[model samples]
Target: MTRRVLLALLLLGLAAGLVGAAAWAYEAWRDRVLEEGDRRGEARVQARWDEDRARAQEAALDKARQDAAETLRRLNQQQENERAQQALLAQLARDRDAARAAADGLRLRAAAYLDAAGCGHLAGDSALGCVREAAAEIGIALSRSAQIAQRVAADADEARSRGLRCEADYDALTLRLSML
Candidate 1:
C-alpha cells in the first residue's frame, strides 16, 4: 500500500508538470502569432501612407507643370504681339518718309514751273494759255502734296497711338509674368 501511494504521487507530479509545459508552449505560440499580426498590420499601414504621399506629390507636380506651360504660352503670345506691333510701326515710318519725299518732289516741281514761266511780258492768248496751264499744274501738285501730307500725319498719329497701346500691353504682360 505504501509503494502504491508513492507511485501515485509521483505520477500526479509528472502529469502536472506536463500540463504546465503544454500551457507554456501554447502561450508562447499565441504570443508569436499576435506579434506577427501586429507587424503585418504596421507594414500595411506604412505602405498605404507611402502610396498616399506619392500620389499627393504627383498631383502637385502635374499642377506645377500645367501652370508652367500656361505661363510659357502667355509669354510667347505677348512676345509675338510685340513683334507684330514693332513691324507695323516700322512700316508706318517708311510710309511717312515716302510721303514726305513725294511732297518734297512736288514742291520742287512747282518751284521749277514757276521759275520757268515768262508771264511778265505775255500779251497773246497762246501765252496766256501757257501761263494758265502751268498755274493749273502747279495748283494740282500743291493740292496733291497737301493731301499726302495730311494723310501721312494721320497715319503717323495712328501708328503712335497703336505703339503706345502695344507698349502698355507689353508692360502689363511683363508685370503679370513677374508675379508668377
Candidate 2:
C-alpha cells in the first residue's frame, strides 16, 4: 500500500509541473503577439505621417512655382509697357522737331519776301504792284508758321502727359510688387 501511494503522488506532481509550464508558455506567446501588433501599428502610423508631410511639402512647392511664374509674367509685361512708352516718347520728339523745322522754314521765306519787296531800283505802278504781291505772300507765310508752332506746342504737351502717365504706372507696379 505505501508503494502505491508514493507512485500516485509522483504522477500528480508531474502533471501539475506540465500544466504550469504550458500556462507560462501561453503567456509568453500572448505577450509576443501583442508586442508585434503594437510595432505594426506604430509603423503604419509613421508611414501615414511621412506621406502627409510629403504631400504638404509638395503642395507648398507647387504654390511657390506658380507664384514665381506670375511674378515673371508681370515683370515681362511691365518691360513691354515701358518699351512702348519710350517708343512713343521718341516719336513725339521727332514730330515736334519736324514741326519746328517747318515753322523756321516759313519764317525764312517770309523774310526773303520782305527783302525782295525792298527793291528801290524799280519805280511806278509796276513796282508798287510787286511790293503789294510780296507783302501778301509774306502774310501767308507768317500765318503758316503760326499754325506749325501751335502744332508743335500741342505735341509737346501730349508727350509730357504720356510721360507722366508712364511714370505713374511704373510707380504703381513697383508698389504692388513690393507688397507681394
Candidate 3:
C-alpha cells in the first residue's frame, strides 16, 4: 500500500476508537446518575416509613396510658366503696348494741313496776299469777320481735350497698363505652 493511504487508514481507526470511548464514558456517567437518584428515592421512602412507625407507636402508647388510668380510677373507686361499706357496718353494729341495751332497760323497768304493783305476790291468787305469766310472755315476744327487726334492717342495708355498687359499675362501663 502507499504510505499516505496507510496513514489515512490509521487516522480513521483512531477517530473511531475515540468516539467509542466517549460513548462508553457517557453511558457510565448516566448509570452513576441513575444509581444516585435511586439511592436518594430509597432513603426518602425509608424516612417516611420510620416517621409513620413512630407515629403509630406514639398512638399505641397514648392508648395504653389511658387504659391504665381508667383501671386505676376503677380500683380507687372500689376501695372507696369498700371503706364506706365498712363504716356503714360499724354504724349498724353500734345501733344494734344501743337498741339491745335500751330494750334490756325497758324490760327491767317493766319488771320493777310489776313488782311494785304487787304482781310478784301471786302465790295464792290464780288471776294475779295468770296476769304475771301473760306479762312475761308479752315481754319475751317483744324482745324476739326487736331482734328480728334488727336483722331485717341489717339485711336491707347490705342489699342497698350492693345495689349502689352495681349501679356505679354500670355507669363506669357506660362512660367507657361512650368514649370508645
Best by TM-score: 3
Better of 1 and 3 by TM-score: 3
What TM-score number comes out for model 3?
Answer: 0.84
Q: Which lDDT values do the candidates have, in the order given?
A: 0.77, 0.76, 0.83
Instruction: Select the stronger candidate by TM-score from 2 and 3.
Output: 3
The best candidate by lDDT is 3
RMSD of 3: 2.4
**Cα lDDT of model 2 by residue, 1-180, tens digit:** 878888888888889999999999999999999999999999999999999999999999999998888678667767776776777767776777787777777767765655676633343577676876666676677777677776777767676857776785676467657877
Candidate 3 least-lDDT 10 residues: 168-177
Alpha-carbon lDDT of model 3 = 0.83
How close is every model to the real structure, measured as TM-score?
A: 0.58, 0.61, 0.84
Q: In lDDT terms, how accurate is model 1? A: 0.77
Q: What clash count goes with each model?
A: 0, 0, 0
Residue 101 accuracy (lDDT) in model 3: 86
Model 1 sits at a Cα RMSD from the real structure of 7.6
Ranking by TM-score: 3, 2, 1
Tell me how far the alpha carbon of residue 68 in candidate 3 is from the true structure, in angstroms, after superposition.
Answer: 1.5
Error of 3 at 69 (Å): 1.5
